[model samples]
Target: MNFHLLRLASMALIVGTLAACSTAPVSTVDPSPIPELLPHGARAGQPAVTAAPATFAKSRWLPVTWSEVPGFDSDTLHEAWNAWLKNCERPTPAFAGLCSEVRRLSIANGDEQRAWMQAKLQPYRVEASNGNADGLLTAYYEPQLDAARQQGNGYNVPLYRLPAGFGTRKPWYSRQQIDTLPEAQAALAGRAIAWLRDPVDALVLHIQGSGRLRLVEPNGQVRLVRVAYAGTNDQPYKSVGRWLLDQNLVRDATWPGISAWIAANPARVNEMLWSNPRYVFFREEPLEGLDAQFGPKGALGVALTPGRSIAVDRQSIPYGTPVWLSTPGPTVALNRMVFAQDTGSAILGAVRADYFTGWGQEAGDIAGRLKQNLRLWAFWPRHLTPGSASN
Candidate 1:
């Protein structure tokens, strides 16, 4: 799954396709097309395919037939039922009524699930205001790293909790200021939940938003813990990889490429780290029982399903909505059902999404290079009127 050549080749093809399409003639028809809606009980026997445009904060949704969704019949719908069930934990107002049926279908077969979806939902192609149906897809995952409860044994980089008066300060402190200033250091003095050996590993934890830590305590006991995102310094996120690319320090900006550059030039590590002013804080959570089997709680306040969950711009697609993701790729061909259960600072736009690839080193490797072209279709409740739900 971590094929660099495949990623590069696919990206090149996507870019070429985009370039060729850019010169094509534009359609004169209205971009935001409104269709007639049927009464709730009118479609008792068949699926409703036409509905008013589902308007959201930043995007529009036009109803389309289920057949229009690529790979609709091929995807293993039952595999995504777990994610759908998770969505029930914090169902959006528009989707609240369907939670019971969603729970009931957890044990159903793929055909049964697909049939239920067709009976209860309408498929809408997600689009921007200008009617662009294409966007970008990226991936993210949880990092699992070893750590020490106390600062010793070469574990100098500390993972801190939010400082006192964190909210009172407008922008808090920048990463460089936190690293160099005594006042900033004092504020976060005893906030360390664990200490990591490498600053780059700490950076990866911050960027990924959450991670599992193999903590070695004072009593010589070992345990696994999770550090979930609590807050940031309110500073903008700047990509260190982008910084390296801009400076011509590396041909590739992925983590592997960055790590190689770091190994070669250790002296300039601080310079590279400080390029991104934002610093994220975390709160520890126990990793046990069923929680250990699942990923971190997403923005929707539910555990995310690996390969079945996606982070989207809330303005475009509301949380709890089931999405059909399609991408023609040299990296990975994904035509499946995924749920909108998370949101990220970088995930913005009608069609753009960040696919959650689960945890561990293998997941990290896949996530780091998963940038490609994407198209999305939202499956919404048939009874709910489009443009009526509050995002």
Candidate 2:
């Protein structure tokens, strides 16, 4: 989980009592962080940040008013209720008391739900310790792709599961090493879960962590299944997109742009794949096309809500917390309540969040193009008797 923390109420003073014990008691209270307001130019497509979003020097939670959250009231809170319910399946002990109430409120109207929030939760705006509220918001999604039950013809790329003794050593094998080395190939020889045509498609699936694979069996029968994250080779993840950018080969850095570059430089595909030594393995699960609509389960171990689920740095925001997010610009103007249900490698920083854009091509389009400004307001249970809690 992302490290997402606090204090107690003052002791009441007795009035008109023996009071020579005076000087107004210089209490050593650590000041609550003051929130930073977003700049006027802040919008959806680009960040209006005062500095680099990733330069993250320091960050903290600053208590904020619900009014300061742009679409707090107007938002369809009920829309995110399902996401909240999913959170309860493995909620932190601090939120145990409110799960029942949240379930009940799920069936209520928006205004009624709004009332519940107003009464039960307090908003804390996430900001840099230096007072920068503006940060970057990218997105991720589940992608569905075609596969072959047996390797042949146009379908030749193999997506393998962990082979025996693979985890015994650290940094088992890099992507290029796995493809070229006999030892690595031996481990995966008889363990091909499925095969695909484009190496890039498999790479995309690996990056996303989970996806639906439409398999064409030996008998020409079609089957759909999910490939969930199993394990990684323990190597560091390198950004292929960044490599292309640094090489001056792609002007637009989105997925589409990268795909176009790949098509032109087909011979360099392995180079791009090798750029990231990190390799992920997967385990297949049964999934029909219709069932895939609900979205694959996220890091929270619960099915994600489309457009309502988000991936935050587990170090900053706990897996099951609810967040009020507001980030507007050219791509999309989002002011809604989303659950922090997942986390990612690239998603780092206190205010950093990745909007879960759901599944398929459309969601992929949004996820690919999304690189905008973001701000967050975390809603925590008021009755949470604050001593210590994940943020």
Candidate 3:
């Protein structure tokens, strides 16, 4: 759901100081954690985000062809299918009827899957209400960092859990306020679930919303866990990168550029951190077994597929929808099937989308730098009211 700050996304957090964030405070957090050791089921106090209706999204759906979808026949269907299967976990009513058929086709070959998709689903080229057929496409990935169970040995940056009365507060505490205020510190006492070696990494975790933390316990043993989005202080997300750019502090504005600026202006790190004011709290989930291999669960409550999952404006393309994303750009030439399984704060607009490129360094590299023009076709089940699709 994010990429407005992908440059150092693995290390950066929050979107630009948008009008909302500019006037308001900055953001703080994201979703999912390991299930086996710390299953996020029936949690005692955690809140659930109730999704709203997508019927208000006004996008024209013009009939298209498989031929229009570049590389449609060549994509590894099995790879995309994994994401599709996850969507089935919480499919929209439109797709719920087709899950049985979807499961039956799970083991089919790429060619068969392609054929089945073409046979069963109708392609609707998604166009904006203004009749624009193209939009921007960016990338985001899961960040991995080393953390500690305690705040000693320079691992002082604390990743907190939700504090009491967090729901009652309009906006929790900003990065600076939280760090400087005694009451804020007192509220967060005993709530530090984990600690990170670098404050920047903690910032990255906050920026990315969720992260994979390889934590070192007091026993000198290391274990991996997902410190996922528990809740934010409810502050609007403000981009630290954008703040740096507006101040003429960084010219490149990418992750590497931010890193250079941090190195050269080490004294200003807190300024950068506090400029956006948003802070994210996390829920620790164990990352052993199969959970270690997949990405954090998306808004759809499904494990996202690397390179095949996308975060969209749910208002435009509802969750569980399959989209044929074609974008010819310098950073990445992408023509593949992606599922709308996630949503982000910055991924607004009918034509906009954020591509999830999987985990680790390579995914992080692509997420930070890849931004391109996009054309998309959202496929729907054919039997839904044989009539014109309206914008």
Candidate 4:
């Protein structure tokens, strides 16, 4: 599992409460303006006066024309509309007014959407304060696993909910303590939301912060449910993959390599599990009808649209912002619009992002190996000054 952890509600509150500031150093480079792309029969209006470069806490935004964005004209805007609509659900003050028009344009053609964007939004090249445009991109996905309401047969590992008085302990019991200590066990007694067959799957669920469980109830009814991140044990997160790499136990530190090592050395499974001190707690959520089609609710408190949702550092890019992501990759090349509807502990930087691949095994496979070079462009409303939290 890639490090897309810590999509907790508390983190969302932090992002939501950041006061808008424009004190970071701005870039001095200026590219010549290019002609805007417009739909057929659309009249050319007076170009909006260009504004000075804006600065956020960790990033600098340099205004650029629509033509500068790679694959901007080619992307199917409607495909990303679902994510945009999700952003509208709890829109930042800057984007709240655009929701209605965004809703109306749900069925708009690519050309029309493109035209609308050009008319209403400004494209700004996102970069670090020191002016580096190149950055890294990783991917994360929801895992699906078979679970049971009660531990039995092969379902020996328990996925627990937050314990009573969990807040009293500054740092709750470590993973090993939770497994071995009677006191910790007592606190977690009767707290198993579901039981899984493999401890590795439990670890993956912990890392991904949410997953879909094909849960068999006590009554023998099997229903699909979602386990979402409620909180953590307040321990520091250490990567087991990094530990394996450091120990020289595995050449590939991805999930597959880790799984292979675990299979070969079954006795040391606990050793590997305990390498990461952090443990996540989850709460069960219903998965029914159209809800089943979406991924877990992100830190933005909205259902993440698989290919179009990305977890970004809120200091660099605010939640609910529309971002244009471009990456040339050995794993997968992408040049599309994605929404910044999630945040992660590991996703920290102006250009760094974690692409949300949809759930299941295939999504998991891609997410495990997807780390690529990336460039980003953020779209802001034409009327509002960039970095301001107002319409």
Q: What C-alpha lDDT values do all the predictions have?
A: 0.75, 0.68, 0.70, 0.77
Off by over 4 Å in 1: 1-48
lDDT of 2 at 232: 80
Best by lDDT: 4
Report the poorest 10 consecutive residues by lDDT, candidate 1.
17-26
TM-score of candidate 3 against the unseen true structure: 0.84
TM agreement with the true structure for every prediction: 0.85, 0.81, 0.84, 0.87
- Write the residue-wise lDDT of candidate 2 on 9-102 in tens digits: 0000000010000010112211222234644224445433222222223456655556566766667677688788888877777676799999
For model 3, give the 10-residue run with minimal summed lDDT.
Answer: 21-30
Clashes of 1: 0
Task: List candidate 2 stretches off by more than 4 Å.
Answer: 1-58, 246-252, 288-291, 385-387
Q: Count backbone clashes in candidate 3.
A: 13
Query: lDDT per residue, candidate 4, 128-182, as tens digits?
Result: 9998888888777788899999999899999999998899997999998999999
Q: Rank the candidates by lDDT, best first.
A: 4, 1, 3, 2
Write model 1 residue lDDT over 1-391, tens digit each, in one string: 1111111111111111111000101121112212223332233465655577767878888887776677787777776888888888888888888989989999888789899999999888888988878888877677789999999999999999998779889699999999999999999999999999999888777776788999999998999999988888888766677788788888866555777899999999999989988888889999988788778888788998888888888889888889988776645678888998878655678888887777777676566557778888898888887645635
**Against the true structure, what is every candidate's RMSD?**
8.9, 15.1, 12.2, 8.4
